[model samples]
Target: VTFLCLPPVSFLLLPHALALWACTRSCPSRCTCTQEKSCSVLCDRINMADLPKEFPCEASSINLDKNNLKFLSERAFGTLPSLKSLSLDHNNISFITPGAFKGLPNLVELKMAHNEYIRYLHTRTFTSLKRLVRLDLSDCNLFSMPDRIFIEQTALKELLCFQNNFRRVPGAIRGMENLTHVYLERNRIEAVAYNSLLGLTSLKYLNLQENRINVIHDEAFKDLQQLENFYLNDNLLAELPKQAFKGLSRLKMLNLGGNLLTNVSKTWFSDLVELEVLYLDRNQLCFIEEGAFENLTSLITLHLNSNNLTALPFSVFQPIYFIGRLYLFRNPWECDCSLEWLKEWMENYKLVRDIPCASPSSVAGLDLSEVVYARLNGTCVDPAELNLTTALPDNPTTENKFNILISKLLQQELKEDLVNSTESFRNGTLLDPAESQVSGGYNGFSTGRALLVLLSMYLIQAETGPH
Candidate 1:
């Protein structure tokens, strides 16, 4: 070999030049690499049919998104021991051989979303990813998964499997106690069986929205005691068991919009004392029994819009003290004396949407806020004065007769109180004591006493009704 002489400065730069050469050689053609902190390779949208033969040994992240890759061979990426993240989104990958991710012991996240052709995965495809914290398999055509595929992923916390063809919640996630979030929206699931979500005790957020689910077993979510936000909107649920939500004590936000629910029951929410925001819009609801929402003491936002409601009992919303937003638009409201209390309540909470009248031709198409009280010509006849033997429904069930009696009694009591208050005001006996030194302060006090009596009677009647 011929001897070569160089400036002294060349020796000082030699190590860096060698390193640059090695980096360049390791980086595949049409791919970009950054050496900051550690190597991060980007091979997105390269139209490649296979993974590059070589990648930097120190690579911490690799992006192979939007490529033509169809298969992942065994030990395909085993050389990148330091890899922490790998993204293969928007590929046509349909198969992943076992041991393909074997050597990546430190991998923390893997995104394989939008791989539409991937209908199945090998049982051991992710067996070595013990430290994985997130795995996104969304937008795949997957209908099922092996039950033990995720047995070794002890540290996984979030799983995104939305937009798939699954007919139910995957049984593979049953024993994943560390899992906190699971997104299974936009699937073809038809129901939630009791064992579907049995063992995920640590789950906090669960999204089953936009599915075809129509039935839910009473104990389907009994294991999710820690769940905070639960989404079941846009399903086909027409009814639920009395204890359908019994174990969700810590739940906050609940979405039940876009369903076929026709009525609301008090026992359905007996255990949801901590619930805050509730969505019941876009349903077929026409009736909500008195005290239906009495247990929702922490409720803040309520959605009842886009339903078939004609009237609602004021007592239904009396227990919720923190209510701020109330959605009541797009409903066929009868702007009668029954809804006068709603107007008064709306004035106190201006966030409530305007109610549009659908009956009583005079107020038809008019906003409830603009209708004068005199326009509400609906009358509430006192049931105590009527001949119950003739006025009551013939051949009625005990439950039906009890419900009718309670409704008429409540209406009569409300009407009498309103009439008394109006008469006192007109007679100058209802003036504020501090402003006018009125000697009839007793009148105002009597009104309060009457309300308490009415509430007590209602509660007593409710307690004695059918279970």
Candidate 2:
């Protein structure tokens, strides 16, 4: 009796359930809909060159992607008042006229990606959708666009111009005030002109990572005060100007890896106060001046692996209060008493791994982490020269003169020890420029070291002259 009564009620509800499904699935011919609320035409490879004559006017999202439509004319969307999204991805569209989407005032998202032929667009093509938030125009092979194409997209937050044929930072992004993330990687951008990024004050993430960027003007990043993450790796950047990163005070992660940067200037990182991670790996870095990282109070991780650093100044790491992870692998570290200060500092430091020595063949493959100060002190030990057994002078003035002589001798030895160490890479053995180019690594460095040793030794000898 219960089953029989349930069927009667079920039969009555079958039409209502069908109606609900029909609201999204009742698509017009050559198209599908989910009960008329959303619809998609099965236009992929169907050779349907034109849009279906009728689209559900009340549908919120209509997927017209993968169609063979070639061009978009004025009023092409025919006053779509309720159409909030339209996808034309993978289509063969070539051009868009002014007022092409004349009536899409409430539209929020428009995806026109993968349309390789859609290169030409009028400045007013997107003028109808003032409420547009996300626009994906990537992979369109567009060489250029009118500067004002995105002037009205004030609320746009994400603009993907990735893998396009842009010659530089597109003029369209200059005015998109609310943008927070911009991906312009792998474009043909060669230079970052001054004030090119001026209007994007609200941007937080900028990736110019894989372009032909060789020059960055001093004022290139002056307006990006709020920018946090910046990626500038894999470019032709040879040198960074002093004011290149002038206004990016809030940047956290700066990736300068994979370039031809030879020196780390003291002023390079003076402004990045909130920075935590800095990547200077995979570069041709040869020298880092003392006090280079003194201002980076918040830096926790620094990567200097795979560089040409042979000896680091003992006091260079003094300014950093906390460094949890430091990578100095693959560099030629000359192990000797020159490392005495570093050994003492490392004992107190947290990380004790991956630091290897590349010099003094006996310890070539040894990890510097295991070596102690006692072992390092052995190589630089010198015999005491002052003979304490000698009779003291009876004159008080004579005694004071003897003490002064000993002081100068000790100071001279200390200076000579530092200059003699191969850690400085100044082995005055430098060959002629032509020959040094052929014998660069060890021979060229040894030549420079020889010259520095001669000059420093002369100075030391003069200080203890005729003692």
lDDT (Cα, tens digit) per residue for candidate 2, span 36-107: 334333334455577665555656777777778887877886766777878888888888878887788888
Minimal lDDT window, size 10, model 2: 381-390
Q: Give the TM-score of candidate 1.
A: 0.76
Whole-model lDDT per candidate: 0.82, 0.72
The number of the candidate with the highest lDDT is 1
lDDT of 1: 0.82
Tens-digit lDDT track of model 1 for 43-154: 9998989898888787889999999999999988856778999999999999989888878999999999999999998789897899999999999999989988998998
C-alpha TM-scores of all predictions: 0.76, 0.71
Kindly provide the TM-score of model 2 when superposed on the true structure, using C-alpha atoms: 0.71
Q: List candidate 2 stretches off by more than 4 Å.
A: 1-26, 35-48, 65-69, 340-352, 370-467
